[model samples]
Target: MRKIKAQLFISLDGVVEAPDQWHFPYFNDEMGAAVDATLGQADTLLLGRRTYDSFAGAWPGREAAGGEDAPFAKVLGDARKIVVSNRRLDFTWRNSEQADGGPAEAAAALRAEPDTGAPVWISGSVSVVRHLLAAGLLDELNLLVHPIAVRKGMRLFEEADASVPLELLSCETFRTGVLNLFYAPAAGPGAGTYEDAKTHLPQH
Candidate 1:
């Protein structure tokens, strides 16, 4: 099965929001290299509506600015994207498709691909991530935890139905107070258990 990996940047308090001020400023050569290395491992990008909108607006401009020769720009331009959104949208980017549904359905479709060589990456979108977590579709998590604390913002982890066990795969700390932690679900039948019922929680 294709692995569904979540690559996120979060605050000390688990807030995954606009990290430009705290984390984006510190994207040096090492960080760029790390990002490139990580992206090299994944061929498909899965995004939520908000993240899809943000990226679709920015990446195309970036690609134009850097021209076709830019490495990151090329990757961003060529990579296939599957966007999950309830609202209607028309994707202009090549190899991009928008699906209306929850994460579980979208993930199941992605996982059902004939070939399992390529990896599917979830960039951002807490709601979709939560759904994937509850559905046990998430395979690996790569979190860049910033040291700064945001007193009030959206948090990455909230109350779920039950606890899910994750095995630490690897960890590293950068000089800019950002720690990279990789984790995978503990191996077992009920390793990533959660409530399977349909319910709603107020947005933050």
Candidate 2:
């Protein structure tokens, strides 16, 4: 079996979409190192269509950039990437595949399949992450919470079909004031649906 983990770049107010518009300022060598470490643990990527397009557009060239992120770019380019989309897409990038089946079922099937020990990673795929949560297929959730609140953008939890409970696994603060929060689905008392988790979120 494979472990599915998600990593998100989010704001204080929980916005996860379009981080490119506001997330760069807080990035630094420390943050880049942290991200590199996370990527090192995964050999497979499970992505939604938009995330796939965004990465396919960017990382290919980075692999030859010979910089701190070059290794990560190489790994990303070499890893087996599975994109979930209803419509067919041209995968101009290497090692990429398309899975159009319903998100939850397809992800579940993928989980049951064999693979290398490295985990399956999901980053910046809000819809895919939501379906993974709904299907209880996610083994870990990592949120890099920046200090600024963008005031407007798509949120990570806005349209989830059910509120899922997550138990804290770890929390670390960076010099840039970014909070790295790690979690797993709740298992003990207080374990409940995502609705149960909403009470803990900031109001819009």
Candidate 3:
């Protein structure tokens, strides 16, 4: 089976949108290596529409530009990309295709196919991640939690989203103070309710 992994760069307060405004300052070699390692495990990328458009505008010709960022740009440019969106998009990138149905349906079909021994990575797609997580199709979620509190952007999980219990797989802290958190879906509703934990509380 092809493993599905979702990765995001999120702030301490849970903001995930527009990372460019505050993200690069904490970037370092360690973060680069962590990202590289994640990409190295996958040949296919699952992207949300906005991210796809941004990448479509950003990565196409960087390889030939021969800069320090060329190698990573090349990797993204050549990887098989699947965009999840109902809206029509102009796919100008190579090896890119729009998903046939909803996120869950698309993921189910992908996983049901012959195991290619390669993982499908969900990159910068918050909506896709949420959908897949809700559908129980995501095998793993990797979050690089930055220490800053970005007071204004869409968070990874919002007030309208349902509760999800996650199992922590591993966690590492980079020198730049970024937290690399890997999590898998837990089976049940979670530890329990406040009422259930009442026994552990001290008497007033």
lDDT agreement with native, every candidate: 0.78, 0.86, 0.89
Work out the TM-score per prediction: 0.83, 0.87, 0.92
lDDT of 2 by residue, 122-144 (tens): 88989999878877888999999
Superior by lDDT: candidate 2 or candidate 3: 3
**Model 2's TM-score against the true structure:** 0.87
Model 1 alpha-carbon drift over 4 Å, by segment:
67-69, 187-204
For model 1, residues 130-159, the per-residue Cα lDDT tens digits are: 888778899888888878787677788887
- lDDT by residue (tens digit), candidate 3, 1-204: 788998899999999999999999999999999989987556789888998998888888776688988888888888989898998777888989999888898898788877788778988889999989998999999999999999998999867646888999999999999999999999776467888889899999
- Looking at model 2, residue 77 earns an lDDT score of 90
Which of candidates 1 and 2 is the stronger one according to TM-score? 2
What ranking emerges by lDDT with the best candidate at the front? 3, 2, 1
lDDT of 1: 0.78
lDDT of 3: 0.89
Candidate with top lDDT is 3
Residue 66 of model 2 has an lDDT of 78
Summed backbone clashes in each candidate are: 0, 5, 0
Instruction: Please identify model 2 stretches exceeding 4 Å from their true place.
Output: 65-68, 159-161, 187-204
